[model samples]
Target chain A: MKFTILGTGSATPITERRPSAALLDLGNESILLDCGEGTQFQMLKYKVRFSRIKYILITHLHGDHFFGLIALLNTLNNTGRTEPLVLIGPHGLQDIIGVQLRYSLSFLNYTIDYRTTNPGAFEEVFSNEKISISTIPLKHRIPCTGYLISEKPALRKILAERLPPDFPLPYFKMLKEGLDVEHEGKIYANAEYTLAPASPKKVAYCSDTIFDLGIASYVYQADLLYHESTFTKELSARAQMTFHSTAEQAASIAKAAQVKQLIIGHFSSRYKDTSAFLTEAREIFQNTYLSEEGKTFRV
Target chain B: MKFTILGTGSATPITERRPSAALLDLGNESILLDCGEGTQFQMLKYKVRFSRIKYILITHLHGDHFFGLIALLNTLNNTGRTEPLVLIGPHGLQDIIGVQLRYSLSFLNYTIDYRTTNPGAFEEVFSNEKISISTIPLKHRIPCTGYLISEKPALRKILAERLPPDFPLPYFKMLKEGLDVEHEGKIYANAEYTLAPASPKKVAYCSDTIFDLGIASYVYQADLLYHESTFTKELSARAQMTFHSTAEQAASIAKAAQVKQLIIGHFSSRYKDTSAFLTEAREIFQNTYLSEEGKTFRV
Candidate 1:
């Protein structure tokens, strides 16, 4: 699994930084999280293909979190995308988009499947054969939820090179399921021809949330985690008042959750230098790293 | 008067070209016309001080014509601008912005003076000491109007070199207004001391309007005129159906109005090359020029 940070800045628009947006590439699918005002431009700049994104997860109704959605949807329709796209967000999202589209007299050329998320509690929202995604209830100024995406366990690997020519394909399925195969009185044990598949990688995204230990269990033991750190420890009161988290608070949550790696971003524009954030986060969580725009990390 | 083309592309959003937006700089004041999506970023990129922009004239309700207004206003408020902004557009414009802001729970820190324009009629809406702005009726898919910005007659010129040493400063105002000065038995004639002021320039902005001869009277003898040419002559029928104009039609309007110079833009994104637009427009009007982004033309 790969995660690309498209933008890491907060509500304020700036030349050097953009608002919140991220891309998750989970081999079989691509998911966009929190598309801000210029997320489409950022995607174009990063060479992120628009058609590849199958799902969009919005955290809240704030303009900085979801303002670019309409433009992105319009561009997708203009580019002739017929693929069914799924949008999972809090209640009122569909109405917001519907009103704007109606006001502009825009008719989408493509289909959009929208799923309203439950904003009050953590629940499993989406799942497919390859991955399972759930939400973590987060405390924010508005109704919001964080996402937890986990890659499902892979099937047993098959050794095609060692197999005889023109082997029955039905036998391969049995072997992949870790079962013994019998073809024309030839019995093949699964252990003799197949190797165990690698363990599934898990990633949890906890963005735009305050420091709350109550939800740590949902993100515990994650292979990789992204959390918002909008300010430094010096502004803890401000962070609490704004329903945001400081670097130290985010790192403390990561340490308590025992996550393998922590990626922190969503910095306030008041901060010109972010090295202090890194230094502060690293004090509590040694595996903490700053999420820079256009930077990608593999899990 | 100076006009800066921020964006000129039509309908579709493009990486190389933007939609429709223009900045009219009238020395002390700046007026934004037709703010397309991402226009605020364009303004920031071009070093346009948002604080100086007191008036915003929206031509139509099309997404490309006014999508950026709310975001720009939000940014302005976030930047702590308390100056009242004047937004002039159709009737529904205020409600569109009001609903969006209410949904997002965003209240502007500054005041916005809303001015709704009447469709399908020429009306003088704004006037000050230096300029008078009137709306010219135009045909479009929605209620739309073009703007005729006329600079008021120049004040009397001040001759600094002709002023006597230690001349009374209060007499300077009378001299600038072309009044004769009578002080200490000295008869200072207005004609002998000062030269004539330069002629005031007039510019007409025709944004997202269909081909119509009625606009000629409003734009007659304009120093500079900007007209939307969404397509060339070959697609004239399609342009009409979409309530748009062709390059030839725009040129014809300029020719009929006897405008000093015609600036044509808002080209359809289907054509990669824009040379055909200039070639076709110039065939009907010799003083036609294509609008290019970031280019400033003095009138």
Candidate 2:
């Protein structure tokens, strides 16, 4: 599993550092987290295919976090998208989108399965064959929730090298089922013809939240953790005043949670140079990484 | 008198070609025409300062034409702008922004002087010392209107070389009033010390309109004409069906209006390469140019 950072800037309109957004690619499908303004451009720059997206999870109603959603939906309609997509967000999001559609005179060509998130608790929000998503209540000025996407373990992979060049396609499923196949007077043993499935990975996406040790428990032992670090250590007071976290605070959460890797983003527009954030974050967590637009991290 | 092309693509979202938007720079103040999705990024990329923008003129209710407006206003408020902004658009724009503000729980620090455009008329909408804006009725799927901006005649320029080393600042206005400056018993004749004001330039912006010769009368002899060219000659039928103009049709309007220069934009997304549009338009109007992002044209 892999997740790509689409935008890193916080609630401000900075040209280079865009607002909050990220894409979680699960090979066959993708999920969008906190689609901020101009996120489509970031997706385009990253060569993201529109058809691959299956779900969109919005953390809150902040304009920087979800303002681009209506237009994005309209564009999807214009581009002739017919697949039904799922949308999960806080309360009032549906009303906001409904009002925008009425004023803009827009029509949707497909269905939007709406799911509202309960920002007060940490619980399972959605689940499918590919992945299961849970909400992580975040401490912020507004009611907000982060998402934890846990990939489902896959079936065993067929070893292409052990199979004959003309091996029948029907036996691949049998191999995945831990069954041996005999074809054309030859027997292929499942033990030697298949590999075990890779361990399922978990990716946690936290957007716009204050520093709280409670966040560590929600994202505990995640393969990859993306947390908001709106300020540097020098601006910790400002961060707390705005109900946002500093880079050091986010790194501390990663260290406490013991996640495999941590990516910090959602920087405030006050600082043009984000190198200081990385420097401060790395001081607390050794495996800390700064989130950059269009960069993907494997989980 | 300069205008920059911020976006050129029509309703559909394309990675390389953005939607329709333009910036008119009038030295001290700027006016934005048809702000599409991601127009702010275009403004940021082109270095269009927000404080200098005094007015925004939207042509229609299409999402691609004005979806970015509310978010832009929010950003302006976040950046601590207290200056009042003028927004002139369709009937439901104020209500749209109001609903968005109410749902997002956002408060504006600055006032927005809202004005609804009359799509069926050709009359002066706004006037100031620098420019006068008038409406041009356009034929489109929805209620659409174009803008004709006429620059006001400027005061006569003072010839710095003809003045004494310590020429007083108070006499500059007298020189513009065609009077001789009596400084230190020296007579500096206004006729010899001043240059006549350059003729006022006019720019006509026609967005999302079908081919119609009636437009020629409204934009007659404009210094620069920006007309929609959503299709090439090969797609003339599609253009007519969609109420869009072909490149040749835009060039025809330029030729009929006797404009000094023509910049055609709002190109259909189907055509990956726009060279054919330039070739088609240039065939009718030799001075025709393609609207490229960030390129400024002097009127």
Candidate 3:
């Protein structure tokens, strides 16, 4: 799986940086997270295939998080996208988009399935054969929810060299399921011919929230964790008042959750340079990295 | 008066060009016209002072014409603007922006006075000491109205050298108003001491509209006329079907209106090069020019 960071700035309109948006590409599907005001332009600049996006996950209704959604949908319709799309967000998002479309007299050529997420507790919001999505309830001035996406574990691989030359196709399924099979009065042990399946990969995204230790358990053991570090430790008081996290706080959460890698972003417009955030986060979590626009991270 | 072209592309999202938006700067005040998606970013790129923009005129409710308005207003609020703003548009614009703000729980620090326009008739919508704005009814797929901004004529210049050395201070006002004054039984002619005031400068903007001859009278004798040229003459049939005008058609209207100069923009995404549009327009109107993003024209 791979993830691309489209924008990293927060509420304010800063010339140097854009607003919040990210793109996640799993092996079988692609999803967009937190489309901000210029997310469509960023996608165009980054050359993202709009039709390949099957799902869009919005964290909140703030202008910096979901303002670009309506335009993106309109562009998709104008470009002749006929595939079904899923939109998962908090309550009121549907109404916001509905009113805009109604006033503009625009209708989509594709189908949109709207799913409202619960911001009070963790719950599975979406699931498919390849991946599952769950909410990580967050603390903010307004109702907000983060997302946890996990790829489903695949079946074991069969070792061709150890198997018989004329192995029956019916027995191969049993071997992949780690079950011993008996064919023609001969027993074949599953361990001897099959390799162990790899563990499932998980990615957690938490943004626009204050420092909350309660969310660590929900994101525990995630392969990758993207947290908002809107300010530095020097402005911790301001961060608390605004319900935004500092770099140190984000690192502490990542360390406590034992995440493999931590990505910090949503830098405040007051910050001219982000090296201070990286320097502060790396002190607590060695695997911490800063989210850069148009940069992709592999998991 | 100076006019800045912020975006030149049509509805479709293209990497080479942006959607429709423009900025007009009169001597005492500045106004934004048709804020499309990413218009705020374009303003930042062009270094327009957000505080100086006291009025915003939206031509229609199409996504490409006014999608960026809410975000721009939110940013202005976030940046701590306390001055009142005027927004003039169609009937449904206030409701559209109101719902988005309600969902996000965002309130502006400044007061927004919304003025709704009638698309079927010409009427004056805004008037101040510096300029007056009127609607140029347009034909489009949706209810749309273009804007005609005309600067009020300035006071006539006083020729101090032609006046008496001990000219009365109370009579200065009369001289500026081009009124003859009798001082000590001597009649001073108004024409001898006062120069004629320059003619009022006028600018008309018509976008996302079809080729209609009825709009020519409203924009007659305008110093600068900006009309949407979405296609070349080769695709005139497609332009007509889409309710848009071709380059030649826009030039015809400009020539018929006796406008001093014509600026054509809102080029379709299908066009990779715009030289053909200029070439087609100049055949009918020699003073025709193409609107380039970030370029400013003087009237």
- The prediction achieving the highest TM-score against the true structure is 3
Task: List the candidate 3 regions with Cα displacement exceeding 4 Å.
Answer: A160-171, B160-171, B182-186
Runs in model 2 lying further than 4 Å from the true structure: A152-199, B153-196
The lDDT values for all models are 0.87, 0.89, 0.92
What are the per-residue Cα lDDT tens digits for candidate 2 across A123-163? 98899888899999997888899999988888899889878
Ranking by DockQ: 3, 2, 1
Maximum-lDDT candidate: 3
Model 3, global lDDT: 0.92
Better of 2 and 3 by DockQ: 3
Q: Tell me the fnat of candidate 1.
A: 0.26
The TM-scores, one per candidate, come to: 0.86, 0.86, 0.96
| lDDT, model 1, position B214 | 78
lDDT of 1 by residue, B120-205 (tens): 77888888788888898988887789999888887788787887887799898888888999878999999987777887778899
> For all the models shown, what interface RMSD does each have?
1.8, 1.6, 0.8
**How does candidate 3 fare on TM-score?**
0.96
lDDT tens digits, residues A1-299, model 3? Answer: 89899999999887878899999998556899999987889999998888889999999989999888888999999989999999999999998888888888898889999999999889999998789999999999888999999888788899978877898998999898889999888999888888988898999999889999887899999999999999999999999999999999999999999999999999999999999999999999989999999999998
Model 3 per-residue lDDT at B44? 91
